[model samples]
Target: MKKVKKGRQEVFEEGKLEVKLEMIPQLLAFGLSIEQIAQGLGLDEQVVRQAAQPKS
Candidate 1:
């Protein structure tokens, strides 16, 4: 019998909040609205916008 391969699991030692914060920029680059990214990631819109900021 052929075995089906499941997707690889991601392990993050930092925390879920950190992972979600990292995803904010990628989500925005993908053209997702701030509200949409916030809702999907279970974060506040303000938080998403803050993460989208360019750091000096």
Candidate 2:
């Protein structure tokens, strides 16, 4: 049996982060500022900004 890291287990098993990642762009399209989105989503501004980046 392989032991997965605790942090990885929590991040993958719980989908909150994934949901937040999905919401960033949707919030932006709805005219929310980066700071507003971060506050509403309880994420760091940098994290929200990264999610809003172009996917090229």
Candidate 3:
């Protein structure tokens, strides 16, 4: 049987709002809207959009 692999889990400091910045892409992949992610992250939508862009 084959096993499924998942990304390693990350831990954030308790009582802090900070999350892994790298989660932007994963959240985008999960179909979350830019606005939703931005609002949830307390960041401007433009910053979220920019971060969501693919790197050349």
User: What's the TM-score of every candidate structure?
Assistant: 0.72, 0.76, 0.61
Clashing pairs in 3: none
Q: Residue-wise lDDT of candidate 1 within 1-56, one digit each (tens)?
A: 12322222222334778989999889988999999999998889999999999878
Candidate 3 lDDT by residue in tens digits, 1-56: 12222222222332233443467899999999998898888778887888788999
Q: Which ten residues in a row have the lowest lDDT in candidate 3?
A: 1-10
Candidate ranking under TM-score, highest first, comes to 2, 1, 3
Off by over 4 Å in 3: 1-20
lDDT of 2: 0.90
Q: Which residue runs does candidate 1 get wrong by more than 4 Å?
A: 1-14
Which has the greatest TM-score? 2
Query: Candidate order by lDDT, highest to lowest?
Result: 2, 1, 3
The predictions' CA RMSDs to the true structure, in order, are 7.6, 3.3, 10.8
Candidate 2, residue 43: CA error in Å?
A: 0.2
